[model samples]
Target chain A: MSRPPYEPPAQSLTGQIVDALLVLAMVVVTLYLPLLLKLSGAGVTKAVQAAPTWESLGQNAVMAAQWEKLGFDPAKAAEIIGSRFDYSFSWGALALTALVIVGYFVVMLRWSDREYRDVIAERFGDDRPPRRR
Target chain B: MTDITPQNLAGVAAPAAEPVARRVALKRVLGPAHVWGLGVGIVLVGEFMGWNFAVGKGGAIAALTACWLAGILYTCVAMIDSEITSTVAAAGGQYAQAKHIIGPLAAFNVGLYLVMAYTMLEVSNAIVTGDLIEAFTHNMGLVGEVDKRAFMVLTIVFLAWLNYRGVLATLTLNLVITAIAFAAIVTLFLYVRPWAPGETLKHGDLLTGLPYGGLGILAAMHFGLWFYLGIEGTTQAAEEVRSPARALPLGTLTGVMTLLIAATITWYVGTGLMPWEYLGQAVTPLYDAARLTGSAPLEVFLFFGTLFATIASANGCINDASRAWFAMGRDRYMPVWFGAVHPRYHTPFRSIVFFVPIAILFAVSTPLDQTITLSILSGLLGYTLMALSVVIFRRKWPLGTIDRGYVHPLHPLPAILLLALCAVTYVAVFLGYGSQLLAMMAFFIVASLWFALHRYKYVRRGDQFTMRWPKPNGY
Candidate 1:
């Protein structure tokens, strides 16, 4: 049997123009929408202000100088550092998260088992032979 | 074998020359190592920089918890992707799988997701590369004020040219740099000697309880995605791999394992060296940790590590994004002109070149965090779709119906877990980035509408099914 010749669909100039404009609009929205939404607030200044200084660097000026030489702001590099984890527990949120995990697992197991068995039965008849493996 | 050339065939009539056009395909020269390179190269940059943001949101313990949770999510992703990609064996990765299992609109959306995710990541990488160089020159007192845009444009151009040349050379380069970046993380881990405790790492003083309680861990899952963001990209090279069935699963599974190890070491080293507050907000936490050691050689090693990881990531992004865009073009989901494979180089040259300007433009103008966030959201959406697609795939073409190189154990469990994890991750992201999440959804909805209304006319529906599989069961 002979196959038909392959010819791509013809696109009109107006159609092409519309595609180009549509693509351009998508690009614009992708690039600028996040910025307009104020998602870029995690800027450098906030990072510098929020960063805590290492206690070891405070006693050693030479090390601190090296850190500054590496482009970190020296003024922002002064503080006593310690473990900030205070074990403040949010029991409600924690319990909720745990419940979601356990509940989803049970639900998925039941649903998936039924669906998988159907597939198995469909592919191989109910009187299928035993596996060679 | 008989040699029946024109000269050898004395009386036999020559076969009639067909009028059909010749089909050009991507070269199949990649091995498992190249597959590993492509997967790891795109992700090792997370070890260098971004993952630490999780610590800022949820503290050290929370960050670690998020790391494990995200690990599970990507583990399911790797398994599901490996199984389906090994069967489909096409260039668009999830997009290709979606097209085969699901319908056109779903496939179209998945294609857009892949393109957007990798392209945005490429832009973020280029911007980071330029910023790293600028910071380096300034620290050395060699240059006063550097124009980062020049370096950003140069990085994109160089990578695009590399991608335009050939797949083998580009991935071989990725393998070398990715290995070095991975080694740097290992070296830092060894240098700290966590086993010896107080000699270097002060974990006793540094290891604290969860700062913001349990909810903080959920929040941290959003940034924890950085640890293994683009690992699923290994499947994007499916069409180019020499042995898609064996190589795809092997590379992807191993790649995920490697990321899990690296993420753990990165978290341990980072939290031990500095306070969680500082580590969370750090632009380059690993480099900052190296400097805290007061060792100049270690500092230099980490500096170069960060630079090389960034470059390698951008390189891998170019390869994956171009492949997805090229596949879409081949199916006429977009203009067919981008479907052209280079006759000499045997690459998606037009698609490779198409992204250079887009990457450069966004690299210079877009905020780094915004681009990263968008990329992550797109990737999460793709993962969610992948979970659904795999279930559909198994039901439509059950076991033994088609050739599967690697069948993931516990059918449908991975798919289900992937969905659950995706839902949790979405909630995590929404807690912090609700507005950006909504806006991105709007953007994809609009793009989907455009695909349905205008783009479908250009796509020849029947011709898009280029695979050699039999008609799907019950279809």
Candidate 2:
């Protein structure tokens, strides 16, 4: 059973608006998301100890207890597992990040396509009514 | 609309009087979406595994840089390949394209090399995925571990069955698997939002060391290529695509772009969470980072992502390898039974069936890194030929003379650059592989011997398949 030849439906105003918004969202995500993630100081970093002694660091009994369970000197453990951060962002990192974001969006758009359905329907040559969204 | 009649297909092998009749046929059910899915899905394992090996070779920074370099190189190949696929639109991917464009011997070599490459890749994926499943099960505290070899065989059989069902089922499964795997990456990216505030960036300096310097960077080249390694496989679906001219370029480029993003994020996030040395040695580095986060849910998410990615990649490889086998068989370069398609499923079922035991044998025997190198070796040979084919075909057809949908932009430059890059990478692969290079050489010799035997058989029969290719006018 052969179906009607595919006729690409007219783009509704809402559909067109959604498409425009998707494009806009993609642009924003690609250009700014990397900088935002970078500025947020969320990356691998070296340890920094604020406390002068194990007692000072382990004022909280829970912290002292946890360090003891791991079988390390409280002072040494404090230094080893201290508050860590990385705020540095290089130009190269930023460029790579942006490239990734853009690539993600491009792939996403292609992966979720109606054209595959159209092609399959045509090849199967079915006469079923148009699928309801 | 493009014609589906066998008479219109320039090089499809069948009896001369009944060119359209065959034991089985491919159903043309793919469009741009499915094409993109196949392109990205087949190669997604690179994102999930293997790439971190580059970190050991050249440190994180240099490895990342190498990836970008390879990305640009593949972008060129993808564009030129898209143009050729659209114009030729044959079933055997690069093999079919090369058959008409570069002649029969070249086609045989290209097709055989591609089959080897995809089979190696699929075998590697099966083994790795089996190990991953066991590890993930342990991580999740699931009971009773299965033997890795048994699991590997099961993975190959399952994916082969999916492919044997038909093209639509295979592509549909690919789309789902790729989507889930990609979603997991997105989840990781969102999780790794803020840079840690106080830790020293020791790895930044690690990038400059390059371990053994130039040799180390060269050693890292194949792992870098992993980022965008199998995007060219998209062309294998040309016979099934509704409009290869329109879909090939859109799908291939889009797929390449998607991989670029996945590779960059996977690298940045994985390295950012842990030191390069630690990340490089771990079996699944990304999942290791999730564990470091100490978030159980995040760990589970990344684990599922790894699992799905492996499935998608292996499944796609099975589809690609079988098609190459089918093409070779149809051309009578191999046993005719391998060319038989299923009557109802419209698939190259016999080829799929034949491929399984061989893939299982490979998966059970080879170690992971060696399997990876073998795949890369065959891939480099195919890539070299494909880039060369771009130049030869362009010169022979000269754009206007042929009915083509996509014309490569900045014609000849991409082809030239691809040739040079592939030459450099080939040297890099050779320098890196040491003893494994000898094994690859041995494999090449074996392939050559097989080709010689095949040629002899064809000559003796006097009903040579190679002689029948109708020469295009003005070439």
Candidate 3:
């Protein structure tokens, strides 16, 4: 079936703002929720997969135990989860993500003004022409 | 929006210099996000060995040194490519632009080199993922062992099927994969926070010598190089992006720096606790880390993350390789069938279909190490050509003509130095790829022979693919 064109609502600016704000809030939650869940619990589904049978899940659990010997701590019992099964590893990982995100944001914002790179670029002469194909 | 008519894009091949009336889709050139996707994808496949190598055999100092060196090399390449990107954001990207300077043969070579490189990358990625999957399976107690050959076939079939849907499908795949993989990294990061407390500020130097006399900084460089592989991939997506002139350079920088920082942090925390040997031996080190953290959720996250890394990378390979092939076909170098876009997908579906089986066969047959070494060789070779091409293109058109208008700063130095350093790095990495140089030599021979046969065919048809290309003893 041919798809119909998307039509924007003929509404006031309020509608757009409301929609955008909703999206923004959703973004923040999505960004941090996964981290929070990971640090807090060990029962969360990993990700979307070709849904496996219960048998497969059960088998995987047995295998997960073997892995614990190799280094995988299901309850994060060793280090990440200091409590009986406290999962702090998940939180530490969150901190790491924050570092990367901040670094990326800072670099991008600084470069956006196109000022900082000028000194290095200036060495190349005024050959810096704005080209649009 | 105007609907696409049958008349638009009617011919599979159009004039190389201009887009046919309907062929030009009004979209933005690639943004930083696309570039990051491509780079990450390429690295995921292209530099699997380096990642493992740093963890396993390389010394702490070696790995650290490599990271710094890679950072410098990547920065230079980014600066150099930005100029070419600005000039030809609308031209045939690297292909058309290079043809203008070096002529048709070299142009054909560039496209062909790209195809070969991406194909190798996909196979390499599958092989790496296979290794990771094997570990995951063993951890799950699902099997006695995982056979690489079987895994290769599975990975190839899955990737081909996924890519058969085209660019959006692939992009969707890339985004999902990146998100999951990022999550895994986050999990590992969190686990390291309460690490052997009170030892945080002890190490004065980042490049501390490895315990038990390890590989030192070489391992770090290897991983660094691996991580930086696809940083400039956004250039190829110029035809589909929005305001690439503003986006490409900045995006390239953003994407690479993100991975760079991630690798650096991961290395610091990861190696700090686990022995490099233990880390190296792990089929899935991140997963191992997750397991060690004693978190069931993190374990699953790591497993799924590896899956995403592999799948997203495969999608990226398909998208990038197909586009280059399409360009080649349109230019009369490859079969015209490679140029045809799917009506529904608006993708070079035929090219991707052709590409997948080849990758599958190689992935299934070649040893994972061999596949990895060859992929790096292939990618580095293409990058070397691109670096050189940038220099030549700049020199040929010093007074760069402005259409929509974007330009580079200097003509000779940036391009010249980039090519020089790229040449040195390319050769060094090539040597670094294998214990024996014999296989590397053999691949070169194969590439050379293929070029020769193509040249002979071109001559017979009285249509030299190198009509304008520089003939360095028919190189």
Model number with the top lDDT: 1
Q: State the C-alpha lDDT per candidate.
A: 0.74, 0.66, 0.51
- How far out, in Å, is residue A34 in model 1? 3.8
The candidates score, on chain A by TM-score, as follows 0.42, 0.37, 0.23
For model 3, the superposed segments whose C-alpha errors exceed 4 Å read A1-133, B1-32, B44-50, B55-57, B90-93, B143-151, B194-223, B403-413, B423-427, B430-438, B441-475
What is the DockQ (computed on Cα atoms) for candidate 2? 0.01
Name the regions of candidate 1 deviating beyond 4 angstroms.
Answer: A1-9, A36-133, B1-22
lDDT for position B224 in model 2: 82
Residue-wise C-alpha lDDT for candidate 3, range B258-287, written one tens digit per residue: 677766766665554444434444445566
**Top-scoring candidate (TM-score):** 1
Candidate 1's TM-score: 0.82
Comparing 2 and 3 on lDDT, the stronger one = 2
DockQ of every predicted complex: 0.10, 0.01, 0.02
Model 1 per-residue lDDT tens digits across residues B85-123: 887777788887777677666777787788889998888
Better of 2 and 3 by TM-score: 2
Least accurate stretch of 10 residues (summed lDDT) in model 3 chain B? Answer: B459-468
What class would a CAPRI assessor give candidate 3's docking? incorrect
Clashes, model 3? 54
